[model samples]
Target: MRPRKLDQPRSWPFIVGAWFLRPALVMTTKRDWIDGLNIPATGGCVLVMNHLSHVDPLTAAVFTHDHGRLPRYLAKSGLFRNRFLGIFLRAAGQIPVERASASAAGAYAAAVEAVNAGECIVIYPEGTITRDPGLWPMTGKSGAARIALETGCPVVPIGQWGAQELLAPYAKRPDLFPRKTVSIKVGDPVDLSDLADEPQDAEVLAVATGRIMDAITTIVEELRGETAPPERFDLKKARARNGRPLEDER
Candidate 1:
C-alpha cells in the first residue's frame, strides 16, 4: 500500500518553507554543496545522519532533492502535537513516531511501507539531537541497522557540521541575521546485505549497529577535520562471549 496523505489541515506554506526555502538557503550558503557531491539519482535508499540539530533533516532533504528525489523522514510524534505543524508534516509525507509510546510499531510499519514504495527515507539514527559537549554524534540506536539489514537498502551515511551553530538544538530560536553556513558531507552508501537478519543475538545487532555508526563517524571526521572518540560503540563488550572477534585475535 502507498503511504497516507493529509486530508485535514492545509498548511502549504510550511511545506514550501521547509522543502523549498530552507534547502535553498543550504545550497547558497554552502556554495551549492550538493552540486559538488556525488549522490545517486535513483533507488530506495536510507539517508542516515548524525543528529546535531533540527536542520540536519532539512539539509539531508535538500541534498536528496538536488540529486532528483523526494525524502520521507520518520519524525517524532511530539512535533505533530501542535495542530499547525502536524498538518504540515503529514501533508509532506513525514512519518509520525511516538518515541515513548507502547505502540511504536505503527511508525516502523510506515517506514517499511515508504521504502517499499521506492521513496528515499531519511532517519536520524541518534533519534534525537546529539547532547555531547562537542556536538559530535552520540551512540546511535539499532533501528536503522535493522531496517537496512532487513530490506538490503543502501544506507547513505552523512556527517553534518555547522548545523548546530545555525540552529542550536536547545535554543529558543535560530540566528537568522548573518546566515550561518552549514556543511553536510555525504559518504558512500553502505550495504548490509552480507549481515544476517537474525535479531535473536543482541551481539549481532550491536556489531552491525557499531559498523553503521563507524561509517557516520568517518564522514564526520573527514568533514570537520576532528577525530571522534576512540571507541564510539563497544559491540564486543556488549556482546560478551557472543561477540564475533577477528581470527587474528586467536
Candidate 2:
C-alpha cells in the first residue's frame, strides 16, 4: 500500500525533507513502517537504528517523518564540509560529530542538550554501516547508551531491512527499476532504568549498549525470518582479516 500523506508540519526542515524525500520514497521503495506510533508524539527521545546501506538514512528519515517526528541525525562532520550541504545541514539543525577527536565531546553534549529540549535524536550505535557479511547488526558503540543515560529519555530501537537491495554497501550503482520493500519494525523503548541511576562506567555502558543492540537484532531477525549469528560481527576484526583500513565510518 502507498503511504498516506500526512499534513506536513510547518518547519522548514520538514518541508524541505518532505519535498525531496516523499517522491523519492514513493518511487524507490515500498515502505512497511510497523509500530510507528511507538514513537512518542511529544517528548525528548533517542532513536537507535541499525545501519544497513548508505540509503538507509533517507529511508529512515522518511519513516521517522511519516511518524510525525523530524529526526535530527548525529551526522559525520565530513558531510558538513561541503559549502552548500553544510549550509543546508546546519539550517536543518542536524548535529555534526567529529569522530576520534576531542571535539566529539562537544557533539555528545549537544545531543544530550537536544534530547533534554524535547527533540528526537537519531543515532546509529554501530557508528557506520554494518560490517556483518549478512548485514545483521554488529557490535554497537557506547554513544547511544551514554546519551540515554545522560538525558534519561526513551531509547527507541528500530530494525530495518531491504535498503541494501536498492543500494548495497559500497556499491556505485543502484537498482532502481523494481521498487524494494523497506521493512521497518520499531521496538519498545529499551529499559535503561536499572542503569539510569548507576554510575556511568564501562561495564554499565556495555550492558546498556548490549540491550539496545539485542532489541534491534531481534526485530531484524524477525523481519528476515532467520536467526542471527551467535556473536555480533566486529568491523575492526573484519578489517584486520582483510588487511584493509576502515573506509566508511559514517
Candidate 3:
C-alpha cells in the first residue's frame, strides 16, 4: 500500500528538528521499519512504545512522519526549562508532562483534546527508560490506557530495538561507528473492548494498562527474538532494594 501524504502543513520547528535528526539517523542507524501501515493514515490515536534509549524518539518520529503523521510526544517537563528549547517544543506542538505531580492532569487534558481533534500522540507508558537489568520493558504507568479509555481511539503498540547500542541507557556519549541496525515493528491496536464500558476507576485502569503493556512487551520480544521475564521489573522495588531515594533516581 502506498503511504499517505501528511494532511497538514509541517511546522517550522518540526521541519528544523527533522533536518538535524534525519542526517544523524542516516549516519548512525540503519532502519528496519515493519508494518508501518498499521498506524492509521489519518485519525486520533495513541502510539504506545517501549522506551529504550534517548535516541528512540528520533527514530520513532521519523517512522511516524514517513507514514504521514507528525508525532506529538508527551515529554518530560524538564526539557522545556531552556528558553530556546521551550520555544521550539511549543512550536513543534509537543506536550509537556509534569511527571509525578498534580499538574500532570493538565497534560492528560491536553492529550485528550488533541486526540479528539484527530492528532496522533505518542506515549511511553513506562514513563522513563526501563530500569530493567536486561533492557526489557518494566511495569507501566496508567496514562496510555486512561487516555484510550477517555477518547476511545486506537492504541498502537510498537516494539523497537538497537537504539541502546547507538546510545546506551544514561550513557554520556553516542557511538557513531559501523552504523547500528534499528528494528521497529508495529502491532495492531490493543484489545481494550472488554474494558471499554467499565468506569475509569483504579481497578479498570489497572486492567487496561496491563493489556497495553503486555501488547508492547510481546512486540518487543519479537524484535529481540528472546523471552521476557515472567514478571516485569518494578522500579519501586528496585529503589527499595538499592536504598536509593526517589528524588535521586532518573
Candidate 4:
C-alpha cells in the first residue's frame, strides 16, 4: 500500500532494500499483517516487537514499509561488522547497538532522535531472541522504554510470530519447503501518560517496560492462540544456567 503521505524522503538505501527484499519476501512467505494502520502514517513513534528469529527484522521491515512508514531499527553492531554490509546499513540509516556493553546506550540516544525526527524507530525490547521454552516474548530491556519516555512519542507494540518457522532461533538452516505465514499484529499504543513525567528511575523504567512487554505478549497470544507462561522468562537466569536446558528454558 502506498503511504498517504511521505514525511521524509525515501532514502536511496531504503529504496534499494525495498526493491530487493519486498519481492523476495512476497515469493518466499505468506503475509498476515494486521492493524498496520496503527503504525503512524507520518510521525515520530517508537515501534517495539518481540524477537524470535534473525528473519524477524526482514519481515517486520516489509510489514512497516507497506504500511506507509520506513522502519529504522536498533540493529545489533555485529551485523555492521562486514565492511560492505556495514556501509549499506549505515547508508540505510540503521542504528548499531553493542548490546551488553556501555556503548549500547548510544542506540538509545539515536533512537530518541529518530523518533523526534518524525521517523518510526523499531525496537525488539528483548534485545535478542527469546530464551523462553515456548518462544513467547521474554523479559524486556529498558531501551524501548527509555526512548519512549525520553521523547514522549507514541509507543506502538507489534506482536510477531511465524518468522521462527522460517528460521528457528539460533538455527543454522531455514525450512522453506512450505511457505510460512509471517503473522504480524499491531496493538494499541501503550499508554504511559500516568507515568510520563514521573522520575525516570529504575522503578519507573521497569514499570514502563513491563507495560510494553505486556502489550506485546498479549498480541502474540492472540496471534498464536496460546497462553504465554504465567511468568515471563528471565534471560539472566538462563545465562546463570550456562544456557542449558536448550529449548526448554522453563
TM-score, each model? 0.80, 0.93, 0.95, 0.93
Q: For residue 141, give model 1's deviation from the true position in Å.
A: 0.8
Best by lDDT: 3
RMSD of each: 8.7, 2.2, 1.7, 3.1
Question: Which regions of candidate 2 fall more than 4 Å away from where they truly are?
Answer: 1-10, 240-250
- How far residue 63's Cα lies from its native spot in candidate 1, in Å, is 2.2
Model 2 collision count: 0
lDDT of 4 by residue, 146-200 (tens): 8888898999999989999999998989887588999999999999988888999
Score candidate 2 by TM-score against the native.
Answer: 0.93
Model 3, runs deviating above 4 Å: 1-3, 247-249
As a TM-score, model 3 comes out at: 0.95
Model 1: colliding residue pairs: none
Candidate-wise lDDT, in order: 0.68, 0.89, 0.90, 0.88
What clash count does candidate 3 reach?
A: 0
Highest-scoring model, TM-score? 3
- Residues 1-250, model 2: lDDT tens digits: 3343444354676688778878987998887888987887778899999998888988998888778788899999999999998988888889999988898999999999999998899999999988788999999989999999998999999999999999999787989879999999999999999999999999999999999999999999999999999999988778888998764554
> Model 3, 62-146: lDDT tens per residue?
8898888999999988889889999989898999988768989999999999999999999999988888999999888899999
